[model samples]
Target: MQDTRATTTVAQSGHATEVHGWLKWLEVVLVTGLFLAAGFWLRPDDPLHVGNTFAWPVLAPLLIGLRYGFFPALMSSLLVLLVAGWHYDKAAATAYPWGWAAGMLACGLLAGEFRDYWERQLRRANAVNEYSLQRLEEFTRNFYLMKVSHDRLEQQLAGSSGSLREALRRLYGELSQTRSEGLNEESAALMLRVLARYGQLQTAAILAVEGNRNIQPKALATVGDYEAVSESDPLIRYAMQERTLVSVQTEFRKHLKKLDTDLLVVIPLISSTDDLVALCVVESIPFFSFQNRTLRLMAILAGHMADMLCQRDQTMAGSHEWQSLCSQARRAARDAEAFGLPSVLLKLQVNEQDLATLADRMTGLLRGLDVIAVNRANESPSVVLLMPLTDELGLAGYLHRLELDIRENAGRSLWDFASQQSLVVKTEAQVAEWLAREGGAID
Candidate 1:
């Protein structure tokens, strides 16, 4: 398929080149003929008169040089000289007409060289612009990814304590219970409410992504006086295209053709699938503290909101459950080591039958601080559970409960499950070693 595409591209390029060449030659012929006709019409009745037709021929070569370069212009100049020599007296043509022909050739050559120089400069400028744009895009993507990693780390830290874990579990339970289809608008309104409370931004709006990939305002939450901006505002368009947060500035405002509002920032809500699901635009508060970190936090919240808006009637975790668990485990490991907190890593090999039911039971058994990740590298799939701040006694009790639950609910005996548990230590290297021992890397 790739070879066919390559062949097609080459064939199309060749055809375009051939057509361009023919058109260029045709232009030369038409210009040359026009020059010849003009010379004939302006020729003096007496042969020795040598009228202003001598000067008229220069236009042909000058235009040819500007459009088609030196060689074609030189050819046209020579043809003009031949016509002049044929129509005029030999003596008169040989003297000044030869000088005029030389002047025409020099003009064509100089103009052609200038044209080539201009084209070279333009190509270089375009190349530089393209390289700069590529670097900018790379920087934006990396920055956004960094912000996402930071947000995930914060979540991991928040889930480290027992009380926070309980709170998170309750929150997740509530969200799952309330999950429904076509709740995008409510989700956007909820997002705006959260953003307003946290950022202290009075005015805000959420734009949802449509089927055509265009974002339209789905919800607008306002507290005080705010400017009304259209759904197709330039700031929203910029954020969508760049997939990064943008600050409103004079130049961007100019693009919008209106500066009615005190709009401060535009946040892109990118999903786990890397889709830009929505945009959140916020108004800046006067005398309120604002910085890059603030915007980064807002972006993180907006990302969660985007996930909510894109959710359907499926598992509340959506398709990124595995990835989310892996990220949580890695972050928990780092935090455990940094804070000298106890943690346990459990690796379990379970029967493939009723895997989904087994997973759900395990999820119910574990705290929000704990993560369950599936490792399918081996012939049979296995599960790895990361429990933060759990001591040996806690690990033992949890495993016993998990075993009883599986035996009674899944109708499996204790022998159907093979397991290993290790105390998590300080440092990423130690965590990596633990994952390696479990037959998988920290994804």
Candidate 2:
């Protein structure tokens, strides 16, 4: 909304100028007409006192010019001259009252010019004031954003531990094990739980992004005492359009105030492919936790949830780069068992030097859906392939293909590697056992 104070002041100034214009004209007409009437009544033939004495009627234009600027003063001067000329003609005077007319015109013009100069200066000052006010409003808004951000940063550093990353990893693991039904309430509720643990969110709700256009209020899953998410909320609309986290601490406070509910922030759950999965509407949060780091953590958690939800086909696209191979393998194993899809884990040990070459060549031969992870810290580096939709038979065929390709391309066969092991993941238990066999090296 526009600033009400500035708008009202501008409106009042406009009204005052209009009223002053009308009053100026009224005063000039009344004063000049009164003076002329007096001149004609008190001194019939020598109205301007041309016979000898001061010309009183000249004061009309002189005073008007000093008060009302050029136009009114010039008009008053013309009226006086008209009366004087008429009187001179009526009296059959030999010489017209040129002296009196010159004095009146000169006074009016000089005073009008002075009034015009001051009016111009006044207008310039008003313009400067308006510009300054606009700049001040902008500065205040930006300063508020900066101050809030700074306070949040201080709080985060003071109260936070260094275990956020590990906590998020564990949270992701837990989330991955749970089956996501796209935008179902179970998934939304689980996601909110994770956010609450990290963000200290007191009241919040998750609304599914329906048809990629609108947020459907029907499938909302809420926590605490949050009211239903409104379709008309300004913060919601902005967050949906921008596809980002928007909070009261940012520049969207005006929109936040317009909300009928006490909405603190609106965070979009966007997937890896930039798909809008859901909207997380936060109603209440601790003041100490409302900061930039909290925002980033929220976004990260929300994004992880979005990716998991979007992975309805068990793609595991939400896996983080920093996550250990063991985590990815565990997730793959859980998905395999849950979805009744077979997956193969192939482990190959190679010389540290040939590990890069073999992995690069293997990547070209593997399907895009396959995941490859390398453990380079070991003296005998190993490459692990998490191949989904593949079982023992699929693994056998892949080995045959790899053997032929490596022999034909590199003049060496797969048997030249140190050793290899293949496991068909049937359950999460098998994954843990497999990692144990690796002595936690894959982790």
Candidate 3:
């Protein structure tokens, strides 16, 4: 139906153009006939003798050329030629006026060419203007969408609702109290409870993955009426294959019709080392809560859970310094990306003895939000300070104060003891690269 309507509209437009063109040609004929009539009436014996004075008949073709371009002008010039031929035949002249005919044709053709050139330029300018208008409309729509999204996010983050950082802090504190060697059954259940509250999930379960490939039939933790998910379920398979979050609204759009399982979303708990630890499957979620913002929030929570489990696993394996640094760096990176917050990593080369002496002093000099860690396992001992919510100016102020305090307390400057390097954390990959270059491993 739409195609037929579009065809009809185009046919109507073509008919209109044809009618308009015919009218223009008719005007050319009328104007040229009037010029010939007036010439004959003024001087019947020599109607074409105006060539010696002012060739007024040429004005008909020139005007038509200037108005309607080449074709109408050509028509008018042909009519004038016919009149000249008749006049010459009546006068019984032996030779026709070839020079006068050429002059009339030349005026029409030149004027028509000039008209055609400007018309082509006008069409091009119109096309460019139309394209620019379309682009402006698209940009305006996108800007409005972004503005609405920003306002919604601001409402979620404002007042007593508490920030995402606070919620994650509570999650970590709860999880830490339960286990020392990765997430146990109790801690996993606690994590699920927290997720259910924030995600507005009615039914969800955390299923353990054996060897990061096969999922266990029994769920380690569950919220609401949980059921076991089949290994062949498309959503499960896609989430396992992608090692990222999958939902009916996102990556599962293609297989949505063929989806065999009753799943709303699947959240993967992946360790910092890229190991698939487990899967958090949502059997049911609130209609309103199942949106892009909610999915992103769930992903962030899933990351923090993975970090906790991985931290415990690494601690059991006796890599505390690396795990601690990885957790802090990941948190800083996530905060920076989400909230446009800044964090600076200050690395100072120092011996183990100096670390023991200055760690307490540095902690006193820094703000409460700042984090300090000592790495004594490497051949050359060093200290890493993660200053959260700090930019370049804040780092300078802290450094100056630290130097002044160190000089007053020990009668020596900070540079005399240790050389330091600092970086503003933006992404986890950036921090990892900085660590590798500074003789430290992020993983």
Q: Against the hidden reference, what TM-scores do the models get?
A: 0.39, 0.38, 0.54
Ranking by lDDT: 3, 2, 1
The 10-residue segment of model 1 with minimum total lDDT is 1-10
Model 3 C-alpha lDDT per residue in residues 1-443, reported as the tens digit of each score: 01111111112322412235456556788998888888899878767654558788899999877766776678788889988998898889889989889999889878877776766776687699999999999999999999999999887666222546566667767777784466557877988988887788889998887688978878889989988779788888989988888897775566456767789899988766567778899999988788877777778778768877776555322246555765667667865775466889998887766776567778788654566777665577777788876899999998899888888887888888788889998987888787666555666
Positional deviation of residue 293's Cα in model 1 after best superposition, in angstroms: 2.6
- Give the candidate number with the greatest TM-score: 3
Candidate 2 residues lying further than 4 Å off, grouped into runs, are 1-162, 252-261, 314-443
Ten-residue stretch with the least lDDT total in model 2: 1-10
**Alpha-carbon RMSD of each model:** 24.7, 19.5, 12.5
lDDT of 2 at 135: 100
Counting clashing residue pairs in each candidate, in order, gives 0, 0, 0
Clashing pairs in 2: none
By TM-score, how accurate is candidate 2?
0.38
Q: Model 1: what TM-score?
A: 0.39
User: What's the lDDT of the predicted structure labeled candidate 2?
Assistant: 0.72
Report the CA-based lDDT of candidate 1 relative to the real structure. 0.61
